[model samples]
Target: MHDFPDIDYTQRFIFDESDVRGELVALERSYAEVLAKHPYPEPVAQLLGEMLAAAALLVGTLKFDGLLVLQARSLGPVSLLMVECSSEREIRGIARYDESLITPDATLQELMPDGDLTMTIDPRQGKRYQGIVGLDGVDLSACLSSYFVMSEQLPTRFWIKADGKRARGLLLQQLPAARLTDPEEREASWQHVNTLVDTLTAEELLSLNNETVLHRLFHEDAVRMFDIQPLVFRCSCSRERSANALVSLGLEDAQQLVIEHNGTVEIDCQFCNQRYLFDATDVAQLFAGGGVDTPSDTRH
Candidate 1:
């Protein structure tokens, strides 16, 4: 990084006179906190950082009160990489990889040369929407940008970078126009802003502050900057939520699982590695009372 202090935050900005809006996210504490839960290899860790950054950037663009999940699965060395960002700005992520297949310096395409990039937006008040795209790009940023271009038909670009220490990204999109809008002028603005942001280097993206990066790229324009939003590494899983999930498995199925497991049902969160356990009493109360009435938490 640079000589500046480390930061874990996301900032949104838009050109005051144009239809181009963008967001910049720099994650240090949150990224390292998630990695602290698991000892992922270098390549895997970097990929997870990218996903976490992507999740943070995407979460702010929607108007939902739920969760956004970014999952990449492949038959290659790295089988899974997942990140969850709640509408509240809490983030968590993890990766599953084969140590033998991963090199000390492996690129994303090498580790996950072929996979599906899955983006899920679940609203608390409406039906969940999921979009899937083939991982045809050489990097994670390119793949996500491709997803929006084909799936959402939005002119978008992503500049994501991560070392072992930090994860950061910048996103730019052409906003939807209103009636009587000029298509040619809108397209010109998109191209102009993208061309300028394309000049950002990874060092500047990850090291400098959000304002500095913005001014460096868009100093000539009247860019309106919004208040910075803080992002923390938080896990939203709880015994009650897990129990509700078990209840969905049905009374008979849940009890059967408890019996096979020798007396209690256990659900482990892969993101935080915390285990939420429920005993016979808990299970009975969960079904009989319609919830996880037993609040016993065996965090592992």
Candidate 2:
């Protein structure tokens, strides 16, 4: 195995003579940081890790300039699992679940039954796009694969795995009218690549580096690996954004909240546990269009 940096990153690669392109994502610190935010059950943590990895892999295949959000809402034990990845490779995620309802060995389908996965692309310069699919598949990867096939009309496959500590994913997508033009040739190439990828095991996917994984799967093929783009666990919540949220609630309601909370209304970011406080004076200044002093204890 080649020596590769064991860090959170997504690497893009393409088959030299085929119309298939791929992305490999491995998450360690980012995954750990997300898990640390809340005391999630093992099944929920593992599923959240896989969703985080899936978000990173999907973001690499897009040409957008903003945020990509992967959210799953269900009526099962886990109510919500949300993961966000920006164009800059900054990532953060959170999960909401009923601890008593979640069993130790529950599967994704059992935990998130009657759910839907929503993918939203909020671009900075253009209109936002969103696609939703029923979580009818057995896992996240299968649902997302069906999403691509139904919404994008593209042949896409995902192999994602996550333990409590680490998460990794591989995505293979067939580009349109690229190197392989003939329909039969395209189908054959797609099947060929996916067949090789099917052999990847969960342990190998979670433990191996990007290069070694690619080589092990596509050693006989011509694959061009690109530079790895680093990923980090970053919460986009800030004092200003939190203030803006407070301002959105009219002055009367904001002041009432302050009174209700004993002169301070606090906004706690669920993703990172960062607290933003607005006192009576701060709320008045915010309504008066005056700047408020930044808080010193913003870290988790």
Candidate with the greatest lDDT versus the true structure:
2
Model 2 regions lying over 4 Å from their true place:
1-6, 294-300
Residue-level lDDT tens digits of model 2 in 1-300? 435576789999999999999999989899999999998899999999999999999999999999999999999999999999999999999999999999998899999999999999999999999999999998889999999988966788999999989898999999888788999998998999999999999988987787789899999999999999999999999888888998999999999999999977889999999888888878888888886664434522
lDDT of each: 0.86, 0.91
- The true-versus-predicted C-alpha distance at residue 295 of model 1, in Å, is 4.6
In terms of lDDT, the poorest run of 10 residues in model 1 is 291-300
Q: Tell me model 1's lDDT, rounded to 2 decimals.
A: 0.86
Instruction: Indicate the TM-score of model 1.
Output: 0.90
RMSD of candidate 2 to the truth, in angstroms, is 1.9
Candidate 1: tens digits of C-alpha lDDT, residues 178-241 = 5217888877778899899888888888788877888889889989988888889999887777
